[model samples]
Target: MPIGLAPTVRSKFEHHKIDEAALDGAPMFDLPFNPGVQIRGYSAINQPNCQIIIEDFMPGTEFDWTFVHDEMQYCISGEMEVEVSLPPLYMETTKAHITPGTVFSYPVGARKHVKVIGDAPFRHLCFCPPSPDYPFPTLEQLKGS
Candidate 1:
């Protein structure tokens, strides 16, 4: 039998109302590295191919992230130190001093780390490829500490 590939829109229903007031009241999760850090996100609006996350990192806090899938990050505010690892063949790592308006992409399974160095909070928008492992565990998963 031939399978249909038509696109369909998913409704949030009453359980998830789309209101400015409700959205303003949405809960945010704090980053484990810094209690003052927080982030909020909603499911992709019109596409099933990506998800958006907004992250706020407090000054002096560092976050190490390992991707389960390809991802892109765009800095929105403040400054940070970004360290990215190249492929095994290269065996070289690159570091960038990024500030608001910087954008970068990481290959699937790439490992990256960031440190908030500016006095202001660092904020960024992250987009991840859609996958069964959409919400993967933190880097602590393998650190064993």
Candidate 2:
């Protein structure tokens, strides 16, 4: 048989939908190292290529996250104080107050410390590629080719 490639086509019948209102009161779990900050996500929307997570941070709550994949977070409500830092040796850091309309991104394996900074709960949407490994990627995998 002749070697060949076929054009990719998305099936019209293949689709996904999430009703925001339906997500109200949905069971949200704590993220590691950052317990008390509640979060919910639709895994059907999280394919092999990407993930989407929605979070609700209590006032004065904070957490540290080290991304295993490239990620972008957009504040959807209230505001938050964020301290971003690169791993040791690289050592670049920044602090900012992010409110609604504020957005940011970080490369694979960047660390971030975030604190909700207002009376109201802070809400945000996070978008990122799925990690190469479950939970986290190996050091060698993080280095890339």
Candidate 3:
């Protein structure tokens, strides 16, 4: 299946091919706030109030992000070191080392710095649920942010 292809219809449900080869042709973009960092990904699921994305970050990529809505992420390959700020007052911070099979979540307004480490590209799946207002920012939209 080609990357960016609409979800396949499967008798009242949707299906998407998320293998790395399926996304090899997907376009890559630079994060506006992070120099020397590039990301390539495809949204496999786009529902009225939920979305699922498969993304790859080359080693050496680093950036800070703030969640627009609640999100969950599962690492599929490689590694990342993330520094997260505690909620409420957000006065304290913690670090997590993510590897394949790791699962983590971020609440709305959660902030973190992510660094792709190791020799290979870091791959992950990101899911946003319960609200459709928080589509991942596109390059154009991110440029002004």
TM-score of 2: 0.69
Error of 3 at 134 (Å): 7.0
Question: How well is each residue in 81-136 modelled by candidate 2, as lDDT tens digits?
Answer: 88888866448998898989988888887888888888976876667775232342
Instruction: Give a tens-digit lDDT track for model 1, residues 63-129.
Output: 7766677888888778989898766653678899988899988887667787889687676667776
The lDDT values for all models are 0.61, 0.64, 0.77
Candidate 2's clash total is 0
For model 2, what is the error of residue 24's alpha carbon versus the real structure, in angstroms, after optimal superposition?
Answer: 3.5
| Stretches of model 2 off by over 4 angstroms after superposition | 1-18, 35-37, 40-44, 88-90, 131-145
Among the numbered candidates, top lDDT falls to 3
Alpha-carbon deviation at 105 in model 3, angstroms: 0.3
Clashes of 3: 0
Candidate 3 wrong stretches, greater than 4 Å:
1-12, 131-145
Q: Rank the candidates by lDDT, best first.
A: 3, 2, 1
